[model samples]
Target chain A: MIQMNPSMRAAGWLLTFAVVVAGAVPWFLWGSSQLIGGLPLWLWWHIGWMIVATAIFAAFTRHGWDRYLGGIDA
Target chain B: MPNPALLSGGLSTAATSVELLVVVGYLLVALLVGLVAYRLTGTDAEDYYLASRSIGTLVLLFTTFATLLSAFTFFAGPNLAYRQGPEWILVMGTMDGILFAILWYLIGYKQWLIGQQHGYVTLPEMLGDRFGSTRLRGLVAGVSLFWLFPYVMLQQMGAGEALVGLTDGAVPYWGGAALITVFMILYVGLAGMRGVAWTDTIQGLFMLGVIWIAVAWVLSAVGGPAVAAAGLDANNPTFLALGSSFYTPQYIISTAVVIAFGVTMFPQINQRFFVAESAAVLKRSFALWPVLVLLLFVPAFLLGTWAAGLGISVPEGANVLPVLLGEYTPGWFAALVIAGAMAAMMSSSDSMLLSGSSYFTRDLYRPFVEPAVTADREGWLARGGVVAFATGTFLTSLTRPGTLIQVGSTAFGGFAQLTLPVMVALYWPNTTRRGMLAGIGGSQLLYLSHVFVPTVPVDIGGTTISLFARTYGGWDVALAGMALGAALTIGVSWVTTAGVDEAAERFAVGAD
Candidate 1:
């Protein structure tokens, strides 16, 4: 079992929620059939969002992971 | 340049033979890897089951990647994209990619921590130990096995479909399904987790390489992505846009949520949470998971969507990947890609059978049938369980109950039903055994009712609602069950007397 400060945990969850919602659906891009880079704009939104997700996950694992494991900061 | 005869399942004898040979060669390599891993395996249960908890970052990452992306990714993913549109990418690639990574950290990382501390090998064992209840452990194992059986069968179904398509029906569906079943039982029964992981790593890498090559080759052959997109816009304009009859907001949200939670409960994947050698290894794997998902899913699903614009004719209920490859790529290259698809299926099946055997022996058999079982004897029993379980799934697969996507989604829903209870048990100290059992058992029943019973429409405020519908108001029935399960778990815990507070304290953060 491991623990982290309540404030840190809340912030981590908020970040996760934001990322999840960001990629959940491209509501604003719907009905736009414009193509960029040989793919639909909506499709590109998903692709770019996926890259952003990858970056967020990388940052989370690198920085917040120790706090999750109940390290010195905790 | 497209060969209509080949697309219609009429390949020359030489072409069929060459493709069959390539598939056979791939299977042989997997078997040889199994043999080597068997030689390296230690005698004890931990050594056999968890690979002595020493899997490195790449192996752990690929094994998890390969195990999760099965025949579904190779076949059903593209098939859906071909039928519905590229929005399948949002459901599988973008949303699920991110959601699953988050869960891997929240659920998997915590499981790893507790596993290391208590030396727990199975989810049921951990839950049972925490709540001090053997029946709850056995119940969890039963529910897990119930759902896992269909998923294992799904891989066999995929193998059957892939081979039949690649060989143009020169190989019967039964023959292809039977072939993977026999090999899976042999290696998984013999080598355990070490062998499964080793082969999974090979299969994972092979699948990725072959799919990427197929994508690049197909793109060049179709005169590049720009031309393909133009063709799609001219031919199937609906596909290029979103907000279709199927890709509704609720549909995307529910499917992504269901798959994310469901994947964590899969015996094959859940057990991997305990296999990472260190916190660094686990962190590295989860961090890389979404990227790996995008790499495979985008290409696979995009190829399916592209096939529609290429005017590729697909037979009823057939996967579009093999047909697309056969049209653009040469015989040998297409065969190699099909072999890679087989690799995807085999990787998933082997891991499922390996982890399932552990659940059977440790959680179900040891506690109920033989509490004093030796490590060596338990190891033998687990091997036997693998053989028996594989045989059962193979027999059921011969019936060919549903399409790859249908069967796979049903299994995912079943497993998703277990997630809320497991999560509650893991985090909440007040979660009673009764609450856990009610949550798991109640959710499973609700989910099964939706699956088994026919839908009946009832009028509510002039709006007709279909009871027992697989998807009501675009939301999947699995989410409804999960909502109920969550409610039962939390609601029941608050009112019930806590009998396992002492046992549960061990799982509390910072507790000694």
Candidate 2:
């Protein structure tokens, strides 16, 4: 199996946790009319989370996900 | 896109000509890309099916994104947003990107690894081998084919509507559908995965660029996003807020789960896992997928939502893109945007056709019908399969079963129900073949009953007895079907894990 360093594995799980918690929970943007950058507060919140999700995934891949990717285990 | 009603003030003769020219020109360019890919890859089965597993980072990323962002994004997304409000964006735009991205990482990464090891070309091949059951492989392929036929038909309908909208009814619906069907068959038949990806890249770029331009133009023309919000606030106040009364919280979350799971099992996308050059290439693509998708979806939905503020009245059940653009913008801009929408439809159609062909050739035909067939003959069969499948879907599309969005959801639901079995097969090593079989079989049985049969009945001596009738309620039937499927999968796997030591070992890692 492709191996990852301990810290990188932790980071990967951490990002996944964040994505699950914030991505699916609608309460994070509940009933807010506030607008940021000419968009609804809820819309901005979702968009902002998307950016964070991308950055976290990008970091995970760069740090250790790449190590686990190249070879087939068999 | 739905069936478009003709515009009252039709385009000028010059505009009509230009519009047709732009779409035809785009189709020609796609054909050229296919020819180039054919020259690069030849007609070998391996090269055609998997691009010889040599796709680069950029091509992989765009091809995946472009194929996923089908006519649903270009047409249904905005149309829904225009009708309901920004909440539609929440459902498809913001949520789908994140959810699908996570799935891409969780499922795609491992599939890529195993695919490289085992030379798996289809999802069923992998699953079948994992359980040491040819029946499992055939069933998986069968389920995918069943759902995919309608999905292909949906794209055909989308293309036809896009053309009709662009030309103001001058180009008949069937004419547009036939044009795309022929082009799709030719390109996919010629170059295989390489051709599809290359053309998808070009179409992907076109889809991205043209939508952003349309959004910018519309935003400027309609006095910006803030002004649009303000107008909605004045005229229709509830639209500017979070939860709508119509889109219940249960509906939102359930649909989100359904869509997220559904997308992961798409046969074309599953095949994409096998085509990644490296794990890193796949990682980069997944990491960047949400952002690329957001770039297209956010603008497209907003423009559709904002069109209302500009006083553009779209015909009920018609695509808003053409109506809004035709009324407000010049003919050239309208033509360009319409062509871009067509790109979205064609890009998706080609990939679906290609995947369907592979499933038939590798998963069903070689194993079931013609085991002694040569590799060259299999390649020819794959091409023939594409033509036959496209023709079937085209005939189905002519019937126009439902609106684009409705048919899309049905297709999505069908695919989504299979996600449970896929995940269990992938991750749960102790999952028995019986469990996998039960999961797939039970889910489909329940789903088909729910969707197709109105009630369960029995007949004895010419007297009919209704045993169970479905009740109309708040719960989405699709969500219920998926839940039942997943529950059966998990429950069966837990109870039936004793006898599959060898299968478990195989599933745990790769074949030794």
User: lDDT per model, in order?
Assistant: 0.84, 0.76
DockQ, all candidates in order: 0.47, 0.37
TM-score of chain B of each: 0.95, 0.91
Off by over 4 Å in 1: A1-9, B1-12, B500-502, B510-512
Residues B45-108, candidate 2, lDDT per residue (tens digit)?
A: 6678789999999999888887887877788778877777777766774446777777776688
lDDT of 1 by residue, A1-74 (tens): 36777787769667775755565568888777788878888877777777777777787777667665534544
| lDDT tens digits, residue span B1-512, model 1 | 32434432465687787787787777778888889999999978888889999999999998888898788888988989888889888888644578788788778988888898899988999898888889899999999999999999998888888888887777788878888898788778778788888888888888888889998999998889999998898888889887788888888788888988999999999999999998889888877776788788888999999999889888764578988998999988998888877866886898898889889999999999999999879878888888888889889999989988899999999999998888887878789888887898889999999999999999999999999999977889999899899889888888887773338865755321
> How big is the RMSD of model 2?
5.4
Could you tell me how far off, in angstroms, the CA of residue B10 lies in candidate 2 after the best superposition?
Answer: 15
Clashing pairs in 1: none
Residue B394, model 1: lDDT of: 88
Give the range where candidate 1 chain B is weakest over 10 consecutive residues by summed lDDT. Answer: B1-10
Identify the CAPRI category of the predicted complex in candidate 2: acceptable
Over 4 Å off, model 2: A1-28, A63-74, B1-12, B455-473, B497-502, B510-512
RMSD score of candidate 1 (Å): 4.1
